[model samples]
Target: MFFADGLNCSNFDRAVFQELVDGGLGCVTVCLGFWEDAVASMDALGRFRDLVRANKDLVAIARTGAEIEAIAGSGRCALVIGYQNTAVLNGNIRFPELFADMGLRVLQLTYNNQNEFGGSCYEPQDSGISRFGREMIPELNRCGILIDLSHVGERTSLDVVELSEHPVAITHANPATLVPHLRNKSDTLIRALAARRGVIGLATYANICGEYGASPSKWADMVAWTVDLAGIGHVAIGTDHGRNVGMPDLTWMRQGNWSRIINYGAGNAARPGKVAEPGWIDTMKSFGAIATALAARGFSQDETALLMGGNWLRLYTEVFGETDAQKQLAA
Candidate 1:
């Protein structure tokens, strides 16, 4: 099976690329722009393009399933550039098309805070997707960008699924039924996503996993539980793994520039630092353990393959349209 990570938070560096290759990862979606404005976000995308160009032998940018398969076939990791927040749009409706042209494939509507698009799970009130957000959905679909609802509020996420012409994704979250974390989705939301043929990438972020963080076996149990809720076709892996990340990065990710005071994020005052990673799945190299655990939990090879990456590939094809490779096959 082709191994693809729905969300990996590691910075784009040669070492990180090498680790991805070494870990047998065929494709990975890496967040490039989060809270940056237009200019900064453009710079981030430019730098990402330059990095991929410089490491052509190691990785390639993939916007479609065919590209991902081709790049992986050539022994290079396919990198899918994603944004954790739509701040790069800066209220301009045309920015989705512009960013799509520039190779931004996956975009989350909101981060941990409320934005013009919609409310976030962390927000006290989820006012749902705004009119601007309503306008942006069709634009995103027209541009072939996947709408990700990993950090979006329940109402906003449901609103997106209902509004979008193409199926969306919860790129990195788990089942609220299993963990009850704010970042995890409720069974209703999961069922709603699956009803629209959207996929939910189960996350292994320790805080969100709660007691399941103890081991890979426990994590697989949570995966099984989610599969029962959303079905195997709508489940995948999105380890929110960040290599070499420290407190400063965590603080920035959680607080961004929205708050003057530090937000501990998923962690609280008692444990006010980087959330501890599960020892068994701590690094990029350790990702394959998920497959092993799934197999042990009675998931068949085909089901495990879907959970590993196949499900995400199907969603990518459905939302991003056909590439030259797919067109040829169709011919």
Candidate 2:
């Protein structure tokens, strides 16, 4: 789904998403923060709360599978709140339940750089989760919110997988196909996550592939590698699609930050092995591109479904604890 951000230029309005749903999307894991303070996030949350209330038919905050199904039954899509960073919490743990009530079901502890929670993948020191980070996990579990370790440090993520009572998700990431880079998880970490019943959202980002972003087919190759290592149930789709039409000057800011800068200014803007000819697109289109490539490589329908969205849906359902009523209805 189109994850519209602050730079959305247009209203961070419901209309943008209405357009995408009209265009055809199953569910959207919408963002509430990229880089903002507590008050700013609270403001955004209020706006979103109002938006959901105003357009109940068009948007409903679905924290679990049943809600998604209910929304889907009416021919609309589900909106799940996701925080790219823990900045809103801003070291205060009280916000979890507040945000959860505000429809925030997913949150990543850190963004590109380190915060109070722990070191970022981009940081020189790869220390794991801090005291506050460890302190937050049980609270997150208590509130029934899912943890997303996508951009967190290697140590921090492993620490979370071990500590979180609920299944954690690397909301948007890729398995090593094994070159070690900051963006992708190592095979060992993926196994640890899967063993703990956590979900891995295999990203189609160019950086995740390696120094060179691999081809679209290479993304499928990573999924295949991950499924082989952790099994299909642990794999899922998180397109990390940036509705670039709206949002910040990420390209410029990211250039100087966590990412190791490359020839971003020139035509070679892709992560590395990716299709440099054309750069970043939505994860679904990226998957569609992967499908054709995988077909040539003979990937079957079962595998394709797991890699696309099935595994992600299954994980979300299982981790969030669906009710018996939710089950009887979906059944």
Candidate 3:
């Protein structure tokens, strides 16, 4: 079975795109905008669409499971447009439908800071989902947008999972039981997420992995433990991998416009930059190595398929609905 990467923060550079294509990914969710206002977000989406048009042979945009399957079947990468933050909404509820019409499929409720929607993991006190967030959740559900809570606070994440009609995602994080990082999810949250049939994409990002370090074997152990806790169906990969990322990009992701000084997110004064990715799975091309690692860890082909991409396809089908072709087939 083909696989999907739930979240890839890469700049979508041609070289990066080439690696994804070569890596044998059936589908990938790329970050289209984060911390951008509505206008700027639209512009970014336009540029991304242009990029797909320019490289039509290598990639195609997909908004549903059937489309993703068809694109991958044709030997092209299926790109799912997503946002790391809902800043693009600009406090307007109507924007969800607007972006969804434009082919957006995944929307993260909050990034590293609290916003109109809800509280963030970085916040000292999490107030849970705001009134606007409660209103926004249903709109997002009606529009078929997959809600994401990867960087949200505990109270807020639980609140969203409870309130959202459809299952949500913690698109790229590890278990805090293993790492104890604020960015990682706790046992309670993971169980709650799994109980609701949500998926938590296991991250290969180093800081959250903590002592797990760079070993593919260790990474597989992390995946195994998650499966043991959340069941095999609820775990998947969201590598958070990027290509040619620099300090400026890191600064922008961590600080945005909210902080005058460097926020040093997932970093400190001694190491104030992008955390080193596990060497084995550092780039898109190396992503397949994760499959081999899982196999070595005694996961069956069927189980590995679910972890690699089958589970994500199932989730996408649930939230985005099947395409006309699928409907016709069922009919």
lDDT of 1 by residue, 65-126 (tens): 78888999999999998999989899899988888878889999999999999999999999
Q: Pick the candidate with the highest lDDT.
A: 3
- TM-scores of all models? 0.96, 0.78, 0.96
Off by over 4 Å in 3: 322-331
Assess the local accuracy of residue 189 in candidate 2 as a C-alpha lDDT between 0 and 100. 82
- Model 1 off-target regions past 4 Å? 322-331
Candidate 3 contains a number of clashing pairs equal to: 0
Order the candidate numbers by TM-score, best to worst. Answer: 3, 1, 2
Candidate 2 — what's its lDDT? Answer: 0.66
The 0-to-1 C-alpha lDDT of every candidate, in the order given, reads 0.89, 0.66, 0.90
RMSD of 2: 5.8
lDDT of 2 by residue, 116-221 (tens): 8887777788789889988899988877678888778889888989998888888777765565667678887889999988878765444445633446656556
Ranking by lDDT: 3, 1, 2
